[model samples]
Target chain A: MILDLHNHSIKSDDGRARVESYCQWIRKKEIPIDGFVLTEHRQYDDESDYRALEDEFGLRILKGSEVETEYGHVLVFGVNDDLRAAFDFTRIDLPLATVLEESGRCGAQAVPCHPGRPNVGLCAHYETRGVPEGVEIIEVASGGSRAGEDEAAAALAERHDYAGVGGSDAHIVSHIGRCATRFPREIRDEEDLVAALREGGFEAVRWT
Target chain B: MMVEFGDEFEFQPDVSMPTVKSFTTEATRMDFWRFTDHEKARELGGLPGAIVPGIMSQGILAAAIHRFLPGSTIRKIDTIFRAPLLVDSSPTARGVVTHVDEEEGTAEIDLTLVNEAGETPVLGTAVVEVARAE
Candidate 1:
């Protein structure tokens, strides 16, 4: 199963494209992406919209949020409504380690998003200091704008002994499937997908 | 008052025109990253010398907006990277106020970050909240 595990939609502050628009672009490009995770930033408003797209497009869609942690940005996948409701998006006082621990306990994978960006958020220091136990993937691609950063991220993943994952980190429709990761096993659900990633059953691939 | 759509802005380089060699030298001197080598900058998708940070480009856009539409606080910015900006490149940041909602006290500006080579390194729009002057 190929999955673009990190991405954004109109739900994010920086995103300007709809979920359906991105799905359509994937189909048009003939990219062999089997699933996509809508990891919108700090907002869970797009869950219904993403579900609708999944039903219409027949693709495995995962719902998650990329929260801005004190150390940097972290992806919290597999977060159910109850858990999301309990968490506060504006709280940035928690240490990186505490955030990772909570995310792990919640059964959500705490993958850091775009650690190489110069100054916006997370960097190598946090990644090295507070990496969670099931932290399996490092984002190696984003919207074709930061190929150099992607390469650096890939190197970091290799250095840290983590699996490499790529995503467009796209906020616009044209960028959805620009990058993805192909898994070695068939993932039937969110649990299986997370397991596949944890077991190192994936390879990063770019669409174009 | 807002600057109407289609307004133009320009920023001239310290020197008249730039050659590839000068561009490379200027890009190498930028302190955004620890490395100062042209090849390293190139490897980082920066033009073959000292490339400006994308945030710097955004800063230039912020300056342009402040110049035309004073008292505007940048609420959101979305930028798309198109090409590498060579060092010493004479790039101009331009913007136009596209939409305004009177009740929300917000305006949207279409912005572009372009260089002398006629290449657009980053293009996107920003949403700003304009505060009325006291």
Candidate 2:
């Protein structure tokens, strides 16, 4: 099965598109992908509703949060209440290291979003000491405005021998499913997605 | 006080950050900004003085914006921290309106986090969506 591992819904403060709108567009376009991970900015309070929508539409859905850290946006998967309680993303003051350490504590997977994008990307690691430990995944390709940065991110992932994933980073319906990760195993739930990502059970793929 | 297009707002408020917990994330602590400031802590990765992480200043800037325009969504913020903000002393954050787009209903606000003696440490530019009075 295919999963658009990164995208946002109206739940994200920056997002104005509805999740159902993306679903309808996916159906009409007959997109090869099966579902997407709705990564709202620093919020994941709509998991159950998305799961219900999944059951109704016969498409799988997962939940994640794109956190604005001191450096850039970090995509966090498998977060729980404890993780949410750890940092305030709106503050934009959440240190990257703090989020990684807390992700470890919450048993969540922490991946840097768009490592090559400027300002809000990992390319500016010179400001800090270096890449922090515990980061295992990087978004090599995104459906956002900075597709050019993908090569650098892919290069970073290859050099570090880490897994590279693709996410649309879509705040709108049109960008949905433009980038995704082809998984070796079917991801029926959030746990499976996290496990597949960590075990290298997927490959990043993008359309154009 | 009706805020005009070029009013500079100054606030010398107490700033508190998320208490740095154990390198271990566990329970027990109500302190604002790291319950424990341990020296030689491995989690800190070794640094001089109990300096606040640069990220917290961004939150302080957000708070400043929120106070000025309640219910306004802070769309994006850009901050550059020139020096380490010491955790023990009081630092002030100031904001000024740089531009106003009446058609788009947005305003560009700039912020500066300063030391007690008045040194600009963190500089920020934020775009806030607001409904300005016509």
Candidate 3:
């Protein structure tokens, strides 16, 4: 199953696209992908229901969150009540160590996103603190990255021997499937996605 | 204050260095690195330079509308931030009258602020109360 693992909707402060608009654009553009995860910045809304849109569009819509930490912006998938309670996702400078460990304990995956970008990327943080513990996955191919940024992220992932995933990191409708992760097996829900990441048989692909 | 349907006007506000700098300071709590840091902005998203706040762009539109209509009062202004407007870059605010209610002295104008890069960083529609012509 191929999924655009990172995306943002109007819920994000900077995101401009509506959830239905993203689905409509994907279908109109003929983006051949299974679905996408709406990784809204700073907060995850468990109450957000997209079952109707998913059914109508034949896409699996999932919810995740992109949060800022001392290490940079991390994309947390399979977020549960425990992870939410353990860390306040609204804080811009959450402790990276605790985030990673707590995410693991909660059976969630916290992957550093756009690891090549400055200020909020892991590469810049690595210069000062090296690698944080339990960072198994990093977003290597980001649709929003400009020029050599993704290459830098790929290099970091390779150097650290970490698994890589791809996401569009789209804030608008047209950018939805520029990059995606292709999983070897079908992923039905957030649990399956976490399990797939743990099982390790996927590759990040540039869709556009 | 008689704005006919299909009438068009353009305005380019001085989004000067001081203006962008001051706006950044005013928006301290909602700070994003891309708005004030040049090198970081380019490094992060390959932006041409530090971007002006989107709200600043919207404010520019409001100012332009007031300038064009003079006695017009903005009843409602809805804006959509399409892209980042780079600091010091010239963006022309264009307004096209779409609907004019003669009895009510109201005009609905389609608005667009196109930057030097030819990108419409802001787009929206505004409803303004035009003064009755003597």
* Chain B TM, per prediction: 0.69, 0.73, 0.86
Give the candidate order by descending lDDT. 3, 2, 1
Q: Please report the candidate that would top lDDT against the real structure.
A: 3
Candidate with best TM-score? 3
Can you tell me which runs of candidate 2 are displaced by over 4 Å?
A46-48, A145-147, B1-134
lDDT of 2 by residue, B1-134 (tens): 13445546767655433333421124333332232353542246353345555556687788898888876778888776655666556888788765566777776676777776544557666878874555
Model with the higher lDDT, candidate 1 or 2 = 2
Per-candidate DockQ versus the true complex? 0.06, 0.02, 0.07
Scored against the true structure, residue B23 in model 3 reaches a CA lDDT of 75
Checking candidate 1 for backbone clashes, the offending pairs are A72-A122, B27-B49, B27-B50, B28-B49, B28-B50
DockQ of 2: 0.02
TM-scores of the candidates are: 0.61, 0.59, 0.67
Residue-wise C-alpha lDDT for candidate 2, range A77-96, written one tens digit per residue:
88788887887755676888
* Candidate 3, B7-110: lDDT as tens digits: 77898877766677777677544467677777888999688788888778888888889888988899998787756777778889888665667878898776
Candidate 1 lDDT tens digits, A10-91: 6777776666656666665566888788887776554364566777877887877788766567776666655565577556
How do the residues B1-134 of candidate 1 rate in per-residue lDDT, one tens digit apiece?
Answer: 44433344555433222433333347544444312345766677444565555555566677777877677799998776655555556777766555566777886666766666543577677788887766
Output the number of the DockQ-best candidate.
3
**After aligning candidate 2 to the native by TM-score, how far in Å is the CA of B92 from where it should be?**
46
Cα error, candidate 2, residue B106 (Å): 26
The 10 consecutive residues of candidate 3 chain A with the worst lDDT sum are: A169-178
**Global lDDT of each candidate:** 0.65, 0.72, 0.84
